[model samples]
Target: MHPVEDHGAPGSGGSRSAAGWLVLLALAGLAAFLLARPILTGPVAGLPAVAQSSSPYTVHRPAGGVRGGGIVNVDTELGYRGTLAAGTGIILDRDGLVLTNNHVIQGATALKATDTRTGRTFPAHVVGYDRSNDVAVIRLSGAKGAGLRPAAFGDSGKVSEGDAVTAKGNAGGKGGAPKIAQGRVTALEQTVIARDDSDGSSERLSGLIETDAAIRPGDSGGPLFNASGEVVGMDTAASAGFKMAKKGKGRGFAIPINRALGIAEQIRQGHGGAKIHIGRTAMLGVQVRPVDAGRTGSGGQSADGGQSGGQGGGQGGGAEVASTLPDTPADRLDVPTGAVITALDGEPVDSPNTLTDLLLRHHPGDRVALTYRMPGGQPVTQQITLASGPPQ
Candidate 1:
């Protein structure tokens, strides 16, 4: 009631109080802006890119070093644990198709894949396996099945030795994230043998990229990345006779990831145990019809399939000599039928395909000689000229 009469000046204490509040509010707004600047810049990177999925890899490391860890974990978005070993896997589909190694999940009774950051583990069911290639695809079920982080893949053939490389995979144990390794490739067109003694089976991996980057068993089934971080190969084995890679012994092997991808896709699409075409490669000119086992003879012993006209499994004798054809690369040299050439460039040649694969490494015009034994066991030397196909 007294305000009208008691007011000292027109806009005195009330105005001052209002101005103070305005200044405080303005300062508070600026403080708020500064606090949220980092968040406002963009979405935080540590979180998974896919809306609600857990990140596949971790951004932080223990401060020593990491090569492809971040890329594998962040990009592949899946990790696996199994009997052969624990490794990383790629999510090939939005519905949770994981591509891993046959050896990784081979003969495993149970499997559990978890996002290292989420503590959420998904039970993975083995969909199918290809023993020929040592590759497998896994399907995740239940809550962790959706919102997967799929990696980008590329043509592996385009990658060449000496190109910069990155690898993503699980290292250590279940707590591990996709670790990184980087180096120039040491070799290509690699051939490594994997033997399953338990089943008396042997398999070979060819067309592989061998690198000096150090990797471990846990790295099997992981992805080998290019500079762009796109997966180019599937991390598989160490170099031939390379049991383990330690410091200063940089060496690792990766299968062309493209092949694994193709197989995995087919398995996901409902073709189980499907034989992959891998594109048949021809090596020699002589095309021997599958000679019947009982009808033909090789090393004087035969099987139901056939004589295996090439080298029979037993004791190594010579480089392979197929049934001769008229005017072909072999016939051009007058290679006598039943002449078994044992070695090429000082190594025992086992299969005709391997020899052909080796020959392809040389130019069509290159000169290749043979060391073989004729029917009488007399050694014969023939300097043979190479050609594209079975010489006419």
Candidate 2:
């Protein structure tokens, strides 16, 4: 045919097309190598590190980092900024009243809680607290319809150290998300000292489980689970260092769930379906830092300051008073929200810590006179009986 002798093969156009594809493939391969250089070299080349460069294993966590069960690596985040909304809680009764650590709500007074997996949020209220036990009960508004999911409680007495344990918490809120951790109980009946940063005092606690699983601040009040998914303890405090204890901030502690259930009973029966037992009233619910010469509230805690912190005259706390129960002693005496309580029962009230200490000496349904400033700008003296709700 036309150039049969000179043409190397038939369908020369096909050969040209194949050659073009080969060129394209080479170019693509080169581009891929160029773009992937970072991931390939930093770790593969054994160079130092840059952000986002790591080996096949292990990730990074900052001071705010959060994770779940077993160091097995689930979702991660920077830290807690009050973003978490819901976690596994105990359903103690048919009334749909749930029990959790008061701190889980962080004194929100009211909140929206949703199941981590279901994405359902419901309105919740602080029902009560038995302070000495640090257990709080919350009543879910319209719990039946709010997709309320209740967790079962495992007997702390039944749990032994070195047993497998699981911890679940809403660490990042939307970012940290929900995570689980797997660990063995390293220590049982461990004595831990906890400092309420709000008041700046330390608490010596016993009967706490020591685990190797990572725990964070927001994890407080969350449920510590067992292999069968039963709760053993309420995540309370991480083992931290004081001037006295040099241990780093890694050990996490939980109030025994069985203990929490006992205190929850009082709160479930008392004031308007909410029982508040004042066990310890010495701790204030605010954190303070030296501000502009005098002092100011550093963390979201009250700026008014309280006696629980490192050093204070007696007591001072700066949490916003949302409101008082109606017809109750506090309400009857006209103790209104927005009043910064500087003292209670003649004790200088600065933080919830001081109040907690005072309450410790009293019983539920006991009446105490409180002097407070009126929101309308008046310093008033009034005596109000303290009605009990739940254990703090």
TM-score winner: 2
lDDT per residue (tens digit) for residues 1-392 in model 1:
00011143433211211101110000111111111100111112232211111212221111221223222221121111101124556666546566776655532335556544344567776676554566777766773454555666755657775777877666533334556677766666666555332222234565667777665545667778878767777777654333344553656777776667667766555554324212111224443222233422344533223212345322333333435545556667676665555544444444442443344344445566656556455566667665533100
RMSD each, Å: 29.0, 23.0
lDDT (Cα, 0-100) at 283 in candidate 1: 29
Candidate 2, residue 31: CA error in Å? 51
lDDT of each: 0.47, 0.42
Question: Each prediction's TM-score against the native?
Answer: 0.48, 0.52
Q: Which consecutive 10 residues in model 1 have the weakest lDDT in total?
A: 18-27
Q: Please give me the total number of clashing residue pairs in predicted model 2.
A: 59
lDDT of 2: 0.42
